[model samples]
Target: MPRRGIRSWFTVRVTTALFTIPLWLDLTAVAVGAIQGAMFAARLTERRIDLLGVALIGVIVGLGGGILRDLLLNQRPAAISDNWYLPVATAAALLGMLLLRVFTKLNGLIIALDAVTIGLFGAIGTSKALAYGVPEVPAVFVGVISAVGGSILRDVALNLPIALMHVGSLYAIAATAGTVLLVVLVSLGVNVVVAAGLCVVVTTLTRLGSVRYGWSLPEQRALGSWRVWRRA
Candidate 1:
């Protein structure tokens, strides 16, 4: 065999070994995402969303990230390819609907779950991108998209302003920080599972802290005012 062929083969194997996540964990992330989506839809009582509408929103939020990630990677979407994802998402969405009042009262729990969901998706996306030999920066981009793709789609489907565009919590920023950390740790030969765990922790903490303290990126107007003040 040619030396180049051997090197490529070795890289593929190592990357695959390092980045693949267990199926159960991935599904858990999907379930949480679905629940969040349903809850968001439920909150819009004024929208007059029907039961079908709620389920659809849940499925979109649950599966949107993975679908987007797969499309970008030019692969079949795992959510569709696997039999379990759709049913799980649908059921979880219904569950969310059933427990809406309870969840609303426990808003902190929802926020915590949201943070963990973001981390899980981000880690999964980054790992898959790395396994596919995507460049580090691009992998981080993919991860962030995977983390927030569902919410983006939900807002678009409902014709609402995209939360990502608005100055809200550190949603994308937290995802980016986690993904970047994963890439850095992996490059340093850290254990893949450990790095992923750390990614989740960092992402979750950043998200929770932002929520707790109302941290947000400066809006365009704020930035403009700062610049004018500097000029003065």
Candidate 2:
């Protein structure tokens, strides 16, 4: 029974990874990521970022995942070198600006897409990291970073508070969990697609559950040496 369960989870992860992406899917994710970047920019920068900022954010969202992957792998950034990642991100950001207000108002839509983004990138991150011979634990970290780095960049650029820093339903936690889960399943000899599918389902459910139930990790305790700090 335990073996079957592992197999099932692994199958789930891989299917989620492979099947969800269509030949035409790049355009959608790039667009969505770009827009997410732009909206983050609009609120982040103390003063508005000009066209350059928008374009940069777009690129960040579109290619950010892949770039982080390469950097972790100790290779040159593919995001900067390869394909249409730049243009796609820029276009998405521009489009995002148009719809951001409306999108923000609709919590459900944002939540749904955000969940998708987390799943896609988190799994990709895990896959790429492992390819570079990253250990399982670090691979999971890489995956989480890829999943959230772009948005984090956008928020920092906009001068808005970092999303991860604030109180919200599990955001990075979901991505990290998915990546780690996939890695564990693969180590156990489960099929790749199944692993990815399980990752996505786990990620989506975790995020939705967090939002639905206000789930959060406990606050960190102070250091072992509890010294009362002197006021300045």
Candidate 3:
């Protein structure tokens, strides 16, 4: 019975570890995030993420979105030019495995945290853009896109329908919602921390509600009965 129980707990740990993993190492937080992301993909189907594959995905997840965000803002590529990023990703990968061992049931917890990450992703992009004097509307969109881009890449690599595309929570919608919220709040003269907190709250609630009640936006389909009849 104990052996069986251990196996069951092990399964849960593996999933959570595979699921909520993040980039934690200070050396290069972004790189760690990328490595953790690819490890996430590799673990979903029980296939080992070899050094090359994991490294590639790690870099992709860690720096790809930021690169795009920076380019859009006309800044230098931080991950490539900076020295600390790669080590950060490596440490984050190892830390994920350790965290998994500690929490046997973390899928839900990870998802919750992932929402916060999304919010941070959006807010960071927006604030940075604004600091650089980018216009409000463009800054907001850039923020929202950067927030969702990492997950999009992670999903595509895993061969799963992007969660943002499926019926269920408004993933992109949440990001968009947060981005707009930030823009409006800032325009109204709210402090950045306060504005960011509100953005995170909205984004988190949007995601949590989707998880809790399976909420999603309306689907598009052609209506066969709605053909227009011309009255001559």
Which candidate should be chosen as best, given lDDT against the real structure? 1
Angstrom error of the Cα, residue 125, model 2: value is 0.8
TM-scores, all models, native as reference: 0.90, 0.77, 0.72
How do the residues 1-232 of candidate 3 rate in per-residue lDDT, one tens digit apiece? 4334423433444344322323342233363355456556545546665655655555566665667788888888556776767666655555554454443366676667667767767766776666566667887878876777766776677566876776665878888888788767766656555676788788878878888888877554423334432331
- Report the number of the highest-TM-score candidate: 1
Clashing pairs in 1: none
TM-score of 2: 0.77
- Give the alpha carbon lDDT tens digit for every residue of 1-232 in model 1: 3334423543765556653567888888999999989999988999999999999999999999999999999889998788999999999999899899998899888889989999999988987787777877888999999999999999999999999888876999999999999888877667667888999999999999899999898777876566656865
lDDT of 2 by residue, 154-184 (tens): 6666666777866664879999889889888
Using TM-score as the yardstick, the better of models 1 and 3 is 1
RMSD of each: 3.7, 6.3, 15.0
Model 3 earns a TM-score of 0.72
Could you tell me which residue pairs clash in candidate 3?
28-85, 28-88, 31-89, 32-89, 34-58, 34-62, 35-58
Better of 2 and 3 by TM-score: 2
Candidate 3 deviant stretches above 4 angstroms: 1-36, 46-49, 97-104, 156-161, 222-232
